[model samples]
Target: MTDTLTDRPRGRQVDPAEFAYADELAFLAAYDEGPRPPGWQLTPRAVVTFIAGSGGTAVELPTKARRKGLPSRLVIGQKFVGDRAVVERCVVTLAGERGLLLVGEPGTAKSMLSELLSAAVCGTSRLVVQGTAGTTEDQLRYGWNYALLLAHGPSPEALVPSPILAAMRNGAVARVEEITRCLPEVQDALVSILSDRSIAVPELSGTTDATVHAVPGFALIATANLRDRGVSEMSAALKRRFNFETVGPIPDLAAEIALVRRQATSALARSSSTFAVDDAVLEVLVTAFRDLRAGRSVEGWDVDRPSTVMSTAEAVAVAVSLGLAATYFPGDRDVLSLVPGHLLGVVRKDDPADGAKLLGYWDGAVRRRAEDGARLWRQLWELRDALTD
Candidate 1:
């Protein structure tokens, strides 16, 4: 069944990507005349189209039996902004039922890509295990309800299946976020599941419920931060099970600016406020992010790169802050003046030395731009004390 915008309750804070794009997903599912892998909702080509968009081309729906209220043609909206090749490779990897691992710097949207893929392929992205240092084998495998376990003694009724196990049983995609954060042993729990396509329930070894087998379409998508690679490294055995893909920050300046503006404006709208941020202000925000993140101006002038990550996701956040400030405060402070302080907060996240790096950015890049007659940069340079104070 297709879900319409009106079908969803209003005043909700957030919606899953799958539900948000249900109509598009339904349209693609009907229009896709290609062969799909077993248990998948859409073909690999259609999944790619869903994530990267249909390039504004009209995808014709099935004429054999048109569902009421469904569109006869669809223009798939581009939800993800990155290399098309990267997404293609990810889709192919999942189709082969291999574990797909996305390793990248923070805020590169690795988790977002995983969610989109899972949603498109399986019709749900809820089967997830967030890996942390405290995550245990039980989270990746199964646990027991003490009350039920005491009474039932290792029966299936007493067992609580993990997301991984649930995905395996249902023939769906399962996600493990920050996989490297888990202890090596906890991470190793996946090695057996991926290799054997089944998990043994040792507690029920002598019973009929001793093993749970994965179905045909079952796959795993795991994400790890490149910045935390060595925090708790994955064992070679575990690494051999998955195809690794790296998701980088958005490359084009115009694309980055558009993304920041769109997301920030959406954030403001969610708060029941108008998006009053100007295009010029957004350009400054994106340009500053690009320059700081790359450690050089678009013209290639050298500057000190901060130890902390300066990703497009952070740029969107700062823009959102400025939008909200403009919405509520309304001239209590200048929008341009807030840039330096917001940037200071982003830069000084991990290392105190990052503050010096940001200051150097203001002194070098901002100063040069201001000298070149850029009004926004001049205003930002004037507020350099915001970082220091």
Candidate 2:
């Protein structure tokens, strides 16, 4: 039997999403009373509750069949902070065994949502193909176990199944991250697989090792960056197989700030340190990100937006960096002062001209806010020299 995630060593650096929330998952699975699709671990409704959270409401487990030592009440935690309608559409698509394509700017949590959905639906999220220019067709299909092929000659044991094939055979969800990064030809490999819901093995054809058909509940969740959408745009034939959903940045300032704080604090705690990032500092950071990302400030100032994507995920990262600096290098610098440098780092990616754009934002938005008597903006405006120097 496969070892449960809870069986892994405690000191491991990373925990799979399945393992990290094993208890919660187990509880939810026990309490999932709705009808489920074939080969699905949880019903469609249960899957939604798991990803979007259950609002801390207690779900009652079956009295007769509750596992020994299990809690009777399970409160599912909210993981993704986005539109409920969008998540519902994703769940419905997956239920129909259709491909789900999540396209958005960088750091919109598309990959995270995909992982969470896969985990909730199948109890495993590791069946993934990370798409890139270097990704080959073999990654989407299957490869030959050279040693076994040499000895047995195209036998079943000689075939090494890719994650996609494995998921298909087992009726599980398969995730392809950054699909647009793959060459167009390589991306096309998925077209046949999705349309036919099967993979043909020519090497083992005419024998028992021919085509592998997908069982019910098998689906594909792919993510593509909007910036790279045109790099190697997917063909029309492939696009027809998918239900496209656009994941955007968090729309609420308070919610975004809360997300950044929670994530940054958790990250800091992992290092055996406490989060000391002030609320005021985090507010400034998030405000800046939102303003720059939208190409305008909250006060209605026109700011030159950078070419680089400024996402909530990036704001979390900057907050985490500030927390780490305060924990390790306390008093060396003020957390507020570090904001400009971090924003510069985030905006100056890909294009050198973006740095100047960032500076322009500082001159317009930051200066105007300072003039409005906002102390945080005043401090940020004083640090405008940081961007130039």
Candidate 3:
């Protein structure tokens, strides 16, 4: 809305997706001159493009928006590396003003997709309620300014609005991260909001602000991790009001590798460090992860998948760690040598049995690949001792 992010502060180590990708949002807005849902920033089609990208094609702006200052042609980069169809469903759900819920295994980027959707649809992703075991109903609804409440006594001036409340008032989308983390009773607070699209203020009864109604374009996006089975369950009433989309791990190995490399490079660049980890090393890291996650190697060898979810996000973190170690330590160790320990660390997250599974994976598929003489696998196999050592 303010044109670009140049006016925003550059002090933060990590900026929100909205601030980081302001140009893309602006260009996409001007690029597509089409009908949009009320209170929406970009058209549905452009919103999809903003998430899934243009499939490597450059798009030129229309004559009216084309100018010297703005670039005439720009390509939208794919932020979420998954099916475009999944993204399309999310857009359609929001356009219909339905509460959209993204469910997935831990670290599959469910939260990232939710943030991207909120930012593209409403131009801001800051309106969010992070759900935790200690999260209260007031967090999803509203609280009050204690000082003002005690001094002035339950007036509209004393009401402290939550992010969800602010989003409703502004007709913008709000995000709820780890929605299942909150207690079931606490989570039920959203039922009235999603179903009625209004929040009642009993304290302000008979006042002009007795109830807050949501504007036309308002919606809520929630993310729940599949691995969080015992945390809490969504009530049938609460579940019925929302559309659920499951975000899965990347199915394609090459795409997953590329994603890890790009994300690790981006993360390293943020710290003014170089991504010195090799492509071969990255391929080995990702392939092992994929194999372990699926409980089978690409060659059909049996593997014991760990209790842990070998998520792509974790792979990126491991890649970034290797890059940082290589950049900072320099010549002390080969990046590939760090792979097994990292894999062990990722596997050990859930159970101790996962470590034995990692060793078994080494004894089986890894040894076979080494015997077959694939150079990288042989190097990885040689580092099997690195796991327990």
TM per model?
A: 0.95, 0.94, 0.96
The sequence of per-residue lDDT tens digits that candidate 2 reaches over residues 196-224 is 99999988789866998988879999999
Tens-place lDDT digits, model 3, residues 229-297: 578988899999999999999989999998999999999998899899989989999999999989999
Q: Least accurate stretch of 10 residues (summed lDDT) in model 2? A: 1-10
Backbone clashes in candidate 1 total 0
Best by lDDT: 3
Candidate 2 CA-lDDT value = 0.89
Higher TM-score: candidate 1 or 3?
3
- Candidate 2 lDDT score at position 141: 95
Q: Rank the candidates by lDDT, best first.
A: 3, 1, 2
Model 3 regions more than 4 Å off: 1-10
Instruction: Tell me how many clashing residue pairs each candidate has.
Output: 0, 0, 0
User: Which has the higher lDDT value, candidate number 2 or candidate number 3?
Assistant: 3
The regions of model 1 sitting more than 4 angstroms off are 1-11
- Tens-place lDDT per residue, model 1, 29-76, is 888868999889999999999999988788888797378978888899
